[model samples]
Target: MRDFIGRAMMTLYFTVCATLKSGAMIVALRDPTWSWARGISVAADVAALGFLVLIVATTVARLPPVKTAQGIEPRLSALIGCFATVTLIAVPGVQTLPQLELVADLITIVGFTLCIWCLWWLGRSFSITAQARRLVTAGPYQLVRHPLYACEAVVLFGIVLRNPTWAVVAIGAIVICFQCRRIINEEKVLRSAFPEYDAYARATPILIPSISTLRELVFPGAR
Candidate 1:
């Protein structure tokens, strides 16, 4: 019953997210100026909508987890980390655009695209919070243990660039800290569920790949 409720809530959440992104895309497309920024915003919205819909579908079809993170702490950390950056919405918009606005938009586009790509690989294993749905060690997982979070960090950095305020920076730091905690909690859950997880973790970088890791990715034969 709890799983059913959680799944329903997650599905509803992603559905709403997709709907909002769709609306944003339409509004951006209909802009009278139709500037480069407008085009980039529309692109980002489209990418966001793509992943959001995928998330909704996957959440509904996801298999039951072998183990879920116990305790309210893990759940709270994940929830806070996921939604903490929403405070940026309350920050006053700056009229004078920073030189990095375009770059930020471009980063957001790439981030959203990468996120969708990762989500495609994640499929039914996707979950907003920490749970060992399945031991996915393929695709982007081959590069990093938490590719989705890495992609999200990229998107979050872009958001900070778009805002470029001290307040936003502070919020970003807070979000990062919470996200790290969430990762820790997730790692514990995964380790508890899968015996091979420890070996995978030892082999894979936690988030950012090391130089050696990148070299290996580019040259699979390199030892």
Candidate 2:
């Protein structure tokens, strides 16, 4: 009974969030002032919204939570990181630095593109909070344990480059701290649910892709 209600509520949450954000993004994209480079931000938003909408699909797919770490810590950490990150990048501040817009835009595009790919790869395994919809060990998962969040970190780094401010620096720091913790909490659930997760974790890096992981692709015992 409680589980059913919880799933229903989550479905509603994702639907509403994805719809509202997508509508706003469409409007923003249609604005005359927005250049093609600015489309990267929209792409980032779409990637996030796409993931949220996919969360609803997980509910419909009836993928049960094999394990979930659902205390305040996991939830609060992710919320704080996301909130801080969004606010720092989205909001305009009083002081603006002389930014290399093209470089920043390119970085952001790569980051968000990777995010979208990973999110799509995850498919129904996607969830905002620390919960295991299912175990996915292919595609981007082969490179890193949490490729979505890893690429998001890259996105935030590019955002900081665009808006180089003390406030942004402080908030981005907080975002990184919380996001790293969110990874731990998420892994707790994945490790709990899938027995094969240990071997996967051993092979892949946590967030950063490394030469060793790449080398292992050929040698299979390079580590």
Task: Check candidate 2 and list the clashing pairs.
Answer: none
- For residues 1-223, what per-residue lDDT tens digits would candidate 2 score against the true structure? 7557766776775676677767767776788887655675566556556655655776555555667787788988976876676554444323343246556656766877787788778876666568887888888899889898888888788777777778777888999999989899988888888888999899888888888767877798765
Tens digits of per-residue lDDT for model 1 on 129-167? 788889999998989999988998897888788777887
Q: What's the residue-level lDDT of 113 in candidate 1?
A: 86
TM-score of 2: 0.73
For all predicted structures, in order, the TM-scores are 0.89, 0.73
Q: How good is model 1 by TM-score?
A: 0.89
Q: Judged by lDDT against the true structure, how good is candidate 1?
A: 0.79
Candidate with maximal lDDT: 1
Worst 10 residues of 1 by lDDT: 86-95
Question: Which candidate ranks first by TM-score, i.e. highest?
Answer: 1
lDDT of the candidates, in the order given:
0.79, 0.73
Off by over 4 Å in 2: 1-62, 86-99, 215-223
